[model samples]
Target: MRASLVPGVALLGSYPAKSLPRDLVAGLVLTALLVPQGMAYAELAGLPAITGLYTSILCLLGYAFFGPSRILVLGPDSSLGPMIAATVLPLVAADGDPRRAVALGSALALMTGAMALLAGIGKLGFIADLISKPTMIGYMNGLALTILVGQLPKLFGFSVDASGLFAELIGFAAEVAGGATVPAALAIGLGGLVVILALQRVLPKIPAVLVVVVLSIGAAAVLGLGDRGVDLVGPLPQGFPPLTIPYITLSDVPLLLAGALGITVVSLADTISTATAFAARTGQRVDGNKEMIGIGAANVAAGLFQGFPVSTSGSRTAVAEQAGARTQVTGLVGAGAISLILLLAPGLLRNLPQPTLAAVVIAASLSLADIPGTVRLYRLRRTEFSLSIAAFVGVVWLGVLPGIAVAVALSIGNVFRRAWWPYQTVLGRVPGIPGYHDVRSYPHAERLPGCPIYRFDAPVFFANARTFREQILALAESQPRPAWIIVAAEPITDVDTTAADMLRDLDLDLELNKKGVDIVFAEMKDPVRRKIDQYELTATIDPAHFYPTLDAAITAFRTTAGAEWGPAPAEEAS
Candidate 1:
């Protein structure tokens, strides 16, 4: 049980000594990227820049101890920043107290961690699939837009006292219109963005974030930009925060819980997808439940250490892997390196320009938006495209947490819609085809006269039983109806009590009204046949009316009723 719960423990026991050097090298490479991105994502989350580093350090250490993946990197994520801010900023409100903000942020992480832990323990990792692909794409695109808009003010060298996407947009415009833009800050910000994007485009292996950050800091110190209207990160706290429980007032629990739920869904989906991608490359098996446990531990650790929630970083994981990371030891080494920085060189990033942080976040947001995926959805499926648009609108208009709720609701609604109105068709024998096929697909196919073979695609349940009964009744009342009405029962995987009862009533009604034109089931599964017996449906539907195969049903029908095959009449099209 312990091994299952903490697979990283098992990994440690089998840890090879030679792999240590590779991990050490990879860890150093990852640190160069982690430091700048962490601070940037922290700012994106509306927390101090230092908390990002705090989060980066602890989440790595925590996942190293419990994570199942050999080398998946976990840290503050750009996609999660707006969500964390949406949760924490409201409670902080007009006061904007840093301590209260940190407390709320940490507590949010705790709530998120607890929920994930419970889900992992319950083996409910399949909950991640609750959000469908199109919804996820739309939700992420909205998030990318939100992040881009939210960071614009900081990038332009000013502050916006606005909440939500539209308000922030309006505020940013007003700030720009009011001549509040600092030329030096904007220049540095735009310069950093250019350098980062160019380097990443031309030199994929180079650490663009680290490069931009180091050069920006050097420029800031040499040019005295901080003294000339530009804001600096100043200095982070001297050392790591002691472990302390995150706290918020009782009144805040409900809101925090709502946010945590959304966070948990997004985190699980992101982690699983990222893990699967990397696992495929490394030939590693991904255990979703174990992943949840690892993520839970990571969030719990961050929450206890003055940090906030986090998720897997695909870019960072790729960088680590490309740098020769062989196991979680790479994460531990990175954590240790950051710890040393906090202890010995806390002021190392003091001159890092704040605009460069915005540049980092903006770049990440660009990656999050999936225009090609959205376009593909539009080209392939209109219903799903509509769903994608709805999810996107929900996120942009209703905020991140509410947007996630909308996305989940749309996913479930889409599933129910399909089940409630499944792709039903009438089957007929084609000239050359062996088995019966959909008449809609093979028009002019010969159908047995006076006996229509209907196929209902979905499993019969209480909700769709009425539709089933009505359709069967419609088939019975059709022109020139006679003898047994054949049903292609192969697709009916399940039959509930309501459907069974309805079948019994329908069979009786056919006998009374349609003059012995009873229902004949073909290719019914054995389990469903037993269920029919269990419901005592044989008392109404003839025991002989059920057939093990469609050919058997056809043979029995021909032997009993002498029906001849002929082209479906124009009136039979319905």
Candidate 2:
């Protein structure tokens, strides 16, 4: 039996002494990346910069204890920032109190964490599968554009009163046209961007964001940019994150529930994808349910510490892995470093330009765009590419939270659409081939004289029962009408009640037809066969008609249809 619920505790007994020094150094290095990113993502989420620090500390500590992956880093993520803002923005008071905004964000984290915990406990990790890869590509692309546009005002040292992505873009354009941007802030922002981009190209292994941040701060202090009408992050409150309980009324539960569920979905999806990717590189197994538990624990901790919803950071995890992190100790050490900063150097970034932070966020958002992946999707599958584009439009036009719903709906709809009009083909024996193949792909292949094999590539469910019945009948109506029709049931992993009823009706209809055609199943799995038996379908269609394989079905058909049917095509040819 396990000694504790925390996975990290179990691993501590066997922890290698050789890895400890490397883990410590990696942790310190990771703190350099985490500080600026935490603050930037907090601002991105429409919360105070310091809360980002609080979030980062608590979430890291939480994941270090509960998370299964050794190097996985959990923190406020760029992709999830706009989503957090979208969720809590509507509930903020018209006057906008930072305290209220923080409370709302914390509440969202709590709700999101609770939902994730329930999902993990229920072993519903498959919920993450709802968002297909194409949908995710589009969603992230749209979110990137949204974050980029939203950050432009900060980078330009201006503020825009805009509600959506289009309005923000228009507002930004108008502001630029009116010369409303501060030149000093723009200079700092542009300079930071240049340094970041340059370092990324010339010295990719270095912490470019950290270097740019320190340089930008030095320049700001030396040039007294704050005195020149430039906005700064100002002094942050010192010491550790205070314990917080989100104060929300019962009336707020419904909206918060919707937002929490949306955040939960995106958070789990992001976490699982990142964990799985890094696990592949390290040759480790990822337990999705355990991941959900870890992520949920992190969120819950963040919420209790006055922070917002967060997810796995792929970039940070890579940094830790590259920095030679060997265990969750790296994350714990990183969290400790942030805690020390909060305690001892809280005001170290007081003169840091907000525009530079905006630049950091913009760079992170740009990384999330995944342009190459989208292009590859387009080249590989046009229809799926179109679906991705549609998801993008939904996010850009409908807003972030609603766009999640749209993406999920599109993914599910795509599944049903494919099933409703699933690909089906007639099978024939090609001269040089073994078993059977699609006749359409091998036009020269000959069909069995009085038997036609048809294959439907999706499960037989209510959604496609009618189509299945119609298509099979149409195949029977062909010039060389089959006396016995065999279904290639290998792909039909499931058989719902509606489909079973349809099958029964079709059997009766075929019996009444003067052509005397019979329908049989080939290569059906035992579970589906059991379902058929439960449905009492054998009363109308004989149980003996079910064959374990296509070859067995063909042999039965040959024996029944007579020698004139020709020794089973392969045997005759041999």
Candidate 3:
């Protein structure tokens, strides 16, 4: 093994070393979790249960080799399952020709993996942050609800049409009413759900899924659920997944590209969030780009190894961490365990009941609801809450892709609205406070002596550059036409060429004919100032107008423009 690959304290640069026995114990405990979840999530993805085993094996091995997290467990996540199936089923007949569909799905995985890897190398992982928290919450909640509603038929031994969520609901209602809800299948599913939920609440450390699996399989075996008409998993393939490549045609590539990009974005978002959460728990710093690379490698391996795309399984990772897992060694062990099960107990898996798996999926989906979180967000910010609801409704009514698109567009629109109508506040000094603040916020606050300083708390890009200039002009139109306007550049971290040009033009307006107020910048960083200098803005605007600090800018304005100002006027009685 490479020295860097070794599990040691020095590998993370800082953090304590964990004992080998602890990691082994954690691996064994989490393996129990990984096996059942792998199968359940594969079912969720509309793939054969055995594919879940294959997915578990390859993704674990991949993460062990390349993932930076000491305890992250990668496998088929419930969140991505419906996405994969929805993306693939429309393009081809899922049941009629599994081979072609599988190939296309694999191709999508490979493309997504390649995209994530490229993004990581390009240091563009920050793009994941563009997926606002509200959007994610809404998306997850909608997906979970869809999965729950869609799985009801399977759980109740009925069938559902694949038209859409509404169609499925109608079909389920028509087919699964009253006595049609098979006692055996419904009982098994509901029983499993109740058991998992109960165990999760009571004995979370006991690997509830594994316990439920063993009990349900045992009950099915004893009661002979097959003879009573309950569907079974049937026999699984014994051995490791054979090496395979997805066959992609030009036409298929175009069809799958949109879905592939969606998967890539979702996968990156999920992995980064998981990595950051675990890193926080362990007091380790996560490298977002590195996390992306690891996730990409895992998906690539999954695609090549007859497996579906994978992401960091949050439940399993938490289990591993809670069980004392220390390093990637735990993942390696878990991988070996999954492979062993695939090789040895392929026949035993045949007796696994479909409803039991559905229950497991339903239970997992329940956690994704975040009702309390949604309520809190609604209380805190009505606009954000509305956006989240819009996303949820879009996902439920339209589809996942359209929902994401709407959510992103809405977020971008909100940002533009905030930038265009930038809020301006007049500064005033408070009785007990030393510095001036917004007069609107602090009624007793006093303004700075001469210059009226205003801060536009956003990057001055093309979207808002012209608006920023207009706002500055409006401020200059005040009765006395303030002698100086110091723009607090702290929040304006970036300035594009358009903005620099506008500033230069504004400086000309102030200097040439005094058509506008003189503009000065405070707390401008070197990179921004460099751009300004490169644009020859200094030719029209004085270099002395830029100050390194707000205080310095105030001092200069007091010296240069203080004589033109008068004392504060009394407020008019309301």
Candidate 4:
């Protein structure tokens, strides 16, 4: 039970001796990326740069203690940064007190963490399926564009008072036209971008961001770039993050709840997806509920340490895996390294150029765009592609929080839309084939002389109940009217009350038909048959009409009608 609750204990118990060096090295390498990213994402969340470090430290430590994924690195993420800013910025006083912003941010994180924890405990991990793959692609693409546009002003060494993506883009353009951007900052930012890109192409294994950061800092310090109108991150405070509880009035909690729920959904979705992907590669399985708990713990720790929410970092996790991470010990070492930096050299990044940080963030955002995947989706499924496009537009035009709602709604709506008008077809037997296939797909196939086999691909639920009845009745009206309507019930796994009523009505309607058509269900699952009995459908329709297989139903039909039937299809015997 304890091992189930604290996965780290089990990981440590089986920790290999030879893996220690690799884990340590991976941890140190991860620190190189985490330090810069933590600060960049922190600023993106509208918090002080130092808080990013705090978030990284606590999240890494917390995840190490509770997370199930051995190599997934938890830290401040670019996607959630805008979400945090959106949720907390409005609540800050007009004067924009930094302390109040921190408190609000902490409260948001705490609330999100608590919600996620409750969801995990409730075993509601299936909720992650709310966002389909297409929706995810759209959401990430929109988020990438949003983050890119939001960072443009910083990249140009200017600030804009814009509210959203379009307004921000307009503000950025106007600033450029007005010559508000500083040349030195632009040079540094562009130089940083070029160096990172070139190194990534030439030597993909190199830590390009870290190298660029060091060079940029060195150049800024030696060339006195700060004096030439370049903005710097300034000095960060030394020592560990102070622990504090987020204080908010009851009134504030209600306002923050909506935002917290949004954050929890987005964060958990990303976490579970990343964990599942990495676990597949490593030949391991991840528990979604346990992952929720781990992520919740990380967020809770971050909130208590004057930090905002965090998520699993795919890039960081990749780096750790490549660096030979063997267990959660890698996260522990990474957290320890960051803590030591805070304790010993917190001001080391004081000369880091702000434009360069913006450049780093922009590069990270670039990774979020999935153009190739989106294009593939378009080529394969046009409707899904359109849904993806809608999700992207929703995020870009409506804002991140509202975009989440739109994306989720579109995902769920797409599911119901498919089920509501499910693909159903009449079945026929091919010349020498076994069983039955869709008549539309096998036009030359022959239909039974006085029976029509029908197949509905989805469950009979409230939404599709009427459609099921209509389609069945339409098939019954076709020429060579079926004396016995054999339903291919293999695909119909469920039958709701509404569907049961619809089925009863259909049975009564068939009974009244002058041709004397009868309905029979073939290959019906036991559970569905039991549901019919529960609905008192057995009293209305003959219980003997339920056949275990299509062949059995056909045999029974032959016996009832005293009609000679053709031999079974070749594939049936095989």
Question: Which candidate number maximizes lDDT?
Answer: 1
After TM-score superposition, the amount by which residue 124's alpha carbon in candidate 3 deviates from its true location, in angstroms, is 2.6
The TM-score of candidate 2 is: 0.96
Q: Per-residue lDDT tens digits of candidate 3, residues 131-153? A: 67887788888888888988899
| TM-score to true structure, per model | 0.97, 0.96, 0.90, 0.96
User: Which residue pairs of candidate 1 clash?
Assistant: none
Candidate 2 lDDT by residue in tens digits, 1-574:
4624578778787788899998999999999999999999999999999999999999998889888999999999998899889878888889888999999999999888889888987999998888999999999999999999999999999999998999999999999999999999999998898888888789878999999889988998999999998999998898876788989878778888998888899899999999999999879998888889889999999999999998999889988988999999999999999999888988899999999999999999888998898999989999899989999999999999999999999999998899899999888787767878886677667777878789999999999999999987886786556788999999999999999999999998944367888898999999999999999999999889899999899999889886233233453234
Clashing pairs in 3: 428-445, 428-446, 429-445, 429-446
- Candidate 1 lDDT, 131-168, residue by residue in tens: 99999999999999999999899899999988889999
Off by over 4 Å in 2: 1-4, 510-512, 563-574
RMSD to the native, candidate 2? 2.9
* lDDT agreement of model 1 with the native: 0.91
Error of 1 at 529 (Å): 2.8
